[model samples]
Target: MDSEKPREIRIGNAERTTALEALGEHYTIGRLDNAEYSERVDAVTAARTRSELSELFIDLPEPTPFGPGDGSAALTPAARAASAPARIPDRREKVVRTLNLFAGGGTVLVFLLLLALGVPMAWLVFILLPMAYGAIRIWAGPGDVDASGIDSAEQQRRRDVESRRRKELGY
Candidate 1:
């Protein structure tokens, strides 16, 4: 009990019992079905002090026994987490990155082959030089992914795979 609050006592046992009976009647009339009525009854029956009862009633509707009353209660958080997928590790992604890096390699090899086969200087300058530049552009060109809304976790996984391929292929 707060020492600062004014308090009064019901004068007799009859008065207290009558007050409790009246409150119970009011509760029963309030459309509290059996489950709720029983839960509140248990709370009230077990209450040892006025403060405990106050705590029990703090913004709470009558209680009900725990059950799958709603669909939410049926599934656990761990089940939700497990159902959500982890990122797919892209095994074939390395092949695309390798293709990008080596798209230029073929042009280089062809130009070299042409040069060794005594292709004329005028043809090499007009054809091979432009082709070599095009190859470099392809190698160092813009990436497949644009600088847009890439999910970072997936991007990191893809980058890791591409880097592994680069190392393996001695790029």
Candidate 2:
């Protein structure tokens, strides 16, 4: 207590406000009752030093700096840091998925419409969208292609087994 006395000297409004906030948080989480919360808040406002402010939180669990709730309690500190940025969806990814869906559906429709209209450049129009989509996929690299229950490796293995069986049956 004697050594802690020096650490509790003349604090400012900011320190008082911070301690008051901590007291409010303690009250909210049921750590401190209504009367205790009010008393601690008054003490915090009157507190003149760091140690004086520290006493309010002495029996309370440490407040999470990341957020208000216990949702992040299970996460590691690094995960908590990473999760803030991870929640935001990437704009580039959104554009890619939208483009893929539109281009795939648009290609066949455009080709058929052009052909039906008897356009001279129908054949050229027919290949353009598909070619553009292929180029985009190649440039962007593969994405979430496995929407079906089966993955590429499993499909390839089934195909190989079927081919071997057909060959053995002389088909």
Best by the lDDT measure: 2
In model 1, the worst 10-residue window by lDDT is 61-70
Model 2 per-residue lDDT at 26: 42
Q: How many residue pairs clash in each candidate?
A: 0, 2
Runs in model 1 with CA error above 4 Å?
1-19, 59-171
TM-score of 1: 0.22
User: Could you tell me every candidate's TM-score relative to the true structure?
Assistant: 0.22, 0.33
lDDT of 2 at 117: 88
Tens-digit per-residue lDDT, 1-171, candidate 2: 477544435777665555555554444434555477557766666677665666555445446222334233455666544432223334445667777787866777887898898988877865787778768767776543343323367545545543453344333
**Candidate 1 RMSD to the correct structure:** 24.7
Regions of model 2 farther than 4 Å from truth: 1-8, 64-171
Angstrom error of the Cα, residue 4, model 2: value is: 11
Query: What is the TM-score (0 to 1) of candidate 2?
Result: 0.33
